[model samples]
Target chain A: MIENEFYSQQNVGPYEYYQVGEFELEEGGVIPQLQLAYRTYGTLNEQKTNAILVPTWFSGTSKNYESYIGPGRALDENEYFIIVVNQIGNGVSTSPHNSGSPIAMEAFPHIRIGDDVRAQYVLVTEKFGITELALVVGGSMGAQQTYEWAVRYPDMVKRAAPIAGTAKNTVHDFLFTQTLIDAITSDPGFKGGRYTSHTEVADGLGRHADIWAVMGLSTEFYQQELWRLFGVESVEQFTQGFLRPLFQSLDPNSLLTMAWKWQRGDVSRHTDGDLAAALNRITAKVFVMPIDEDMFFPVRDCAREQALIPNSELKVIESRLGHFGLFGAEDSYFEQVDCYLRELLASP
Target chain B: MIENEFYSQQNVGPYEYYQVGEFELEEGGVIPQLQLAYRTYGTLNEQKTNAILVPTWFSGTSKNYESYIGPGRALDENEYFIIVVNQIGNGVSTSPHNSGSPIAMEAFPHIRIGDDVRAQYVLVTEKFGITELALVVGGSMGAQQTYEWAVRYPDMVKRAAPIAGTAKNTVHDFLFTQTLIDAITSDPGFKGGRYTSHTEVADGLGRHADIWAVMGLSTEFYQQELWRLFGVESVEQFTQGFLRPLFQSLDPNSLLTMAWKWQRGDVSRHTDGDLAAALNRITAKVFVMPIDEDMFFPVRDCAREQALIPNSELKVIESRLGHFGLFGAEDSYFEQVDCYLRELLASP
Candidate 1:
């Protein structure tokens, strides 16, 4: 591996590192050398009983999840030793953006939700010597990782909260994710994943962000002029300031890597195509939280999968922010998450 | 102007042509020679009282509207003289693709739904010498024209059926349309609207079509494999076989022109921002028909607008096809249209 310091946890943290060495992916690919970039807030007590594993979502970093940690919030670093682990393709991890030639861009092998969970398992069990988690928590693709962690290693995860995502990606969501991928690759500047920099495919990234304007938020979000809350007056301004810049700042190949994993996100893949059986294997208590207005992962879809999970409870988060609600757009959402987490932690 | 017969009504008929010289657009620009292409399925009756006008939707041609204009259909050519006018900028009509200098590609002046309705008015009054229309009917962007006709030339249209669209585009729909536009313009191949062939921006068109895959249809449409109705098994097959080719065949600049018109589709623009007043101006008996699953123009949005039209009846067509339900995907939808149109025409 190239091992660039800029992508290392030390550079992006209050952080730490776990070297998994040669990591094998769920989809039959291998990284010759793998490093997981993670950040830990607060301290791990003697018993390691307060540890919470927070997995990064698609196109997200451990830094972004830092907001949910700290003193009084849901993760509450004051009480819990929160570990925010970056997913493989999110640039800061063993991603196409920072990996060696054999596993970069066009050659970056397929990854899955299970692969990330397995890596997190290695980190939890081998590196920290922590065998059980107080909670496995994340949203969107992070939520996917949470589900994978609980289902794949049930006893290790005492409780899990998969927010704004499903155990198995729905066909509708697959199509949406596919469209997003198409938006990027179709940019001629993408150059078949051989672009020199993210700017080369800026237009592609812009279009990809444009898809988010439609799929990632509710109609009421635009109708109520919530873009104004972000300090932009027009849709053009919102796109320019927030939507376009966010996607353009990330590597195109990195995005493609995460997107492919997102599309193939089914714990059932390991359980011989039986989703209920896969969900049934999860012995950990699960809080299945879905945003009411999330068009991509509608609550109805989450409710369906929640029914299949034997020890899961469905907790619907009402928010006009839609899938982006996990970002703390509304105060009530944070309160809801705090309440849900408190309840999950308090349960016998 | 380059009056190639392929672009003219001569080659693209069952179509006729009407020249409206030196036409001024709504947004303060003029076309030196504007020609409206049209197709009439049945003969003009002696009284001309039976003439019904059908306008084309975005990217649609008069030929495509032929399906709704037969003996037993909505327009029922046997009883009505159905005139299917191709909307301006739809390639076959006077458009950026086939127009001369100062009006091609990037130079093409913004054309509004009102401008199209204005052009159609000339075609109806001057060429055909039709004093009154038995009905003015269309779907999607065609429905915008329908609303414009009823509001602008109220007495001239006896009845109007605007299907699967709204009197004014909603903020959500506008954002969706903007994304579609961005998807095209962001293509580096577009080169600021100076591309050689449509193939140059095939990727852009493909991405644009990808947005439609999300916005133009419902989840049930994908889940039930309604794409199979068009002879495709996978979503990829549907994208390749239908969606991409359909947009690619049309001119990008022309598509943009129509999209711009579609986005600014407010009859309230003519009635001083009072939508209810604009709708109330309709002397024609109106049938405000919306597709049940249409995300673009949801039934709730349609119902809200329809409530403003004094002589209108709200007819909801139940289907899982979303906005595409207007394309006669289900025989039930066609039957609903047939019944609605028959009822409207029969009313005093």
Candidate 2:
């Protein structure tokens, strides 16, 4: 495993790990001795009805949810027990990078969105003896897992919010994800995913950042010169100083593992490719929240699935930040997100 | 210089060359001995008023405009003398790949849209003894040159049509072009633009194709599975069989050269970055044609520039093909383009 301070437990954690031994993957592979890294805010109530499960997104860990958890926020730690679970292959969790010898690096098993939810199920029910979750909320890949949680364990999730992500990955998104994978593997220094350090594949990671600069943010962001908001004078400075270091800090294999799962995030597989049938299984009060400018998961795609769910509402968040708006670059983004999420949680 | 049949004179051409002994660039460089590859259809009349100049776009030769030519079409050979000029660094012309050493490959001087217009100016005024053009039209980078021709020598161009491109390349587009350059240079086999052949950087070329698959085509194109229109069974086949071979056939250094020029295509440079003042200088009757779904040159961007031109109308072409619709992939795309060109040609 390539050691990096960015995702190191010591650097970004006040978290804990839950052991999941010999976990079987959805795609016919075994991740022997699976370990899940998670963080919790507040305490589980005597009825265990106040538990809220928040899954981490691609390249994110449990700590990433800290911004949303505060006294007066929708996910107020004082009112509800918010358990933030890092998705599999997200570095802090048992991933390609830290999985040790035999199943390490490129040899790591291909993960699916279903595999992540199934494992999180064990942590929620077995560890905490929780019978139900007050809410399940997340964005992007975490939103994919949120959809899986609502559909797979319908009765357990009372309220669900899948933000800026579709239940079925679009062919457009799958192709976009492929370019990210191609960017990394094309580097010679990657050494077929056996590189000693992330620095070795700097050029490839830089290319990855370049691709993100085009799609991750909205065109208006560039047109309006919004990078200046980040204190960068030029586009080059924004890309080089900000995006490059952020992605370069990640382990390429870990990213590849998440990307592979992200491309194949199809909840409809449970209902023989029938998306309507899969979404109809949800019993939760669902809010399908998509960012207006999100190229990755356009509002139209999200609305299509939202219409299929029996008890759901399509709540679009306005932002000029595109898919990365989930990072809450503008205060208005989080304000809208919190408003809608609070409404969903307060329902019944 | 890597020799490839894709851009070889005999393979894709029945074109001729014009030698401009020593050409000076707008951006402080010289092409020592510049040669412009051109193809002409029909003959110039005694009045020299039936002449139309068509410039090739990036990665295009004079042949790409063939679909819009011939009998009864807007550019009918019987009605007008049509001259198609391949832009600099597009391989068939004096480019990074074909330019002999001292300034070969990565050593090639940077080219601007103004440099291309100036070189073509010599061919039209000096070689053909033509003081005025009946029409100047093109798409994408060709569109860039069309705008430059109208702005730089306003009186020389009587009618101008720039389709699916902008007067000033957007900051969003500059960053998109960077990803394409980064994809090629990041390849270990590229060897800092010193590769032996095009085949040496196959991975990089493939990554370039991957990026195009995401941005070159519109979202609706992929959402509707339009790749099937190309007779490809899957997205992989469309990308591998169609897009990959299309890009892989060209030399990487040649592409980089065009990409660099493309990113800096700002005719506003003529008026100290005052876009409105630069556009207001145009005396030619102009048709600013932008594809409705074109992500690179969105309708808003084109409309913003068109509103500044004194005698221009913003004509939006509805296409699911996005910017690649300029290739005339569908019959409807060409039908719309022809109808508009016919209108522009018959104007008073």
Candidate 3:
């Protein structure tokens, strides 16, 4: 039972767990026993074929995906059983902070995007006995897992929408991810991931969030004074009150684990570095959506990967919100997304 | 007297000093005794009209300006008395690191680009007895001071080239600058600017450099593996060996001082936020050169500010080198700049 307010399911709920025993990672690491936390809205139809899978992004929980989960939304849970699966190392799931002594903290071997996909596959096939997915969708790191599911188990996924993330981590993305990890571990208080209190690295966490403030969002986000839209008086207030405090409150080791996985995200890893061949493995009717203003995963980068997937369509979300556009920042963007997703889900 | 290798002229030199006594800052802080470090190549003509002023960029020294200075370069010191003035907070100058007690470290007063320009004005007019400048040129934060010189003392600056920087810090630039400052201070070892050794904040410094690895240059730097041009096997090698070590060696407080100045760089502040009014104040033949691929100073953003300057010509340096193109990364870019400078300076 995780007691940490920051990690507990009680804080951001509708969360449940599925036990996937003796999970083995693609990187040759093993978790003796594992539990994957997830949240579901709506009910599984008698066919069980109407279930849609939604995965969380870096530092994002199930609630982050619920922005469009309403009667008439893109992820209208009323129409389908939508399961928001929490990625491993995202605190709510089995993470470095809450795992047992043998597999806790530094002992928590590196997890990869493939490992998360594999775990989710097991939960869906064994626990829910769902043989096919109506749709699999996510953004950012969630998009990474979405790509993994499509390529790794193409037969199980009929449709896929990987938004604002690439099939392979670019050299730039790797560098960005490295910077975040280094920021956390560089803290003297980190103690090689054995720190007594997570807050000891609060400054490092705050710095990590500060980076997101610059790159995670678009230049127009600040220029348009969108901070005021979020009910903040100034950029300083938005940064200090929201961004910094949110990251600073999380477990540093958990963040590191997620970053490590984020860096090694390469769908081509199993296909001998041939990204095209890996992408060709996808049988899913794919909707490759990327935000135009995203600094990390620019539309140019995503478009290249989308072109490689034989059964894919590229949809660009035009917004000044950058990567955060996936968070439903603008109603027009959401409307565009809802229209596209509706067509994607309804298609044969 | 400053023996710290990081702050000492011995490490990066060919520098001299012009003592500008009791310098008063635009922010109302006064340095009891201010010494502006500078390096001069070539000779001041009998006419005292061939002097060129070049201010250093953030974390740069006089030596950085030497890259484009030689017999037949854009900044050919042979034709002009090129004075590379070290921005005040850069370690060699009267920075937080080398400044005397009471006003040292955290106590060092906030600095602005205008203050640096003011000090340079004193060095040019009072110390060297130079009445006018042949040119004033620099990139990044160096460009900031160039803009300040043109706007603040228009008659003294006959010609100016502010490359890869803006007349005013954009909202994105301010956010980026704030991240760098917060990244350093968030280190618990910072001790609120009273650290025993600079390396105590090495992690922060390294993270700071890592940021530049992303925004400082173009995406092509990674895509084309241009790091090979710098003789590094991988981008990681360039970052770990060169970038990180370079910044980690510098004094944290000194970096903070420069960053503080960089963020507050706005020529319009004196013109009551009328950027066009401030640009109109420049009588100098201005060449506002921004790199095509520069992320921080995009061509679009720079073009807007360039259009506002009444007597300005916008020369966009088209190169895949991004902001670093100003550092002579591409020969074609340098040729364009050299051709433009030759034309600008030779005009009767």
After superposition, candidate 1 runs with Cα above 4 Å error? A1-12, A42-47, A70-72, A104-106, B1-13, B43-47, B101-106, B188-191
Off by over 4 Å in 3: A7-10, A43-47, A346-348, B6-11, B102-107, B195-197, B346-348
Write candidate 3's Cα lDDT for A48-123 as tens digits.
Answer: 9889999999988887877878887878878899889999999888998888867888889889999999999998
Two-chain DockQ for each candidate model: 0.56, 0.79, 0.64
Off by over 4 Å in 2: none
Model 3 docking tier (incorrect/acceptable/medium/high): medium
TM-score order, best first, reads: 2, 3, 1
Could you tell me which 10 consecutive residues in candidate 2 chain B have the lowest summed lDDT? B1-10
Look at candidate 1 and give me any clashing residue pairs: none
Per-residue lDDT of model 1, residues A1-348, tens digit only:
323344444645666667999998878979988888888888888998889999988878887776677697767888988889999988887888687778987799998888888888899888888988999999999999998988888888899999999889888788789888988887779989888777898888888887888778877787677877667879778877898887887788889999999998988987899999999999888999999988888887899899998888999999888888777766788889899989998776
Worst 10 residues of 1 chain A by lDDT: A1-10
Identify the superior model by TM-score, candidate 1 or candidate 2. 2
Q: By DockQ, rank the candidates, best first.
A: 2, 3, 1
Please give fnat for model 3.
0.71
lDDT string, candidate 3, B79-165, tens digits? 888898899989888998788876787899988898899889889999889989989998899999999999998878889999889
Candidate 3: pairs in clash? none
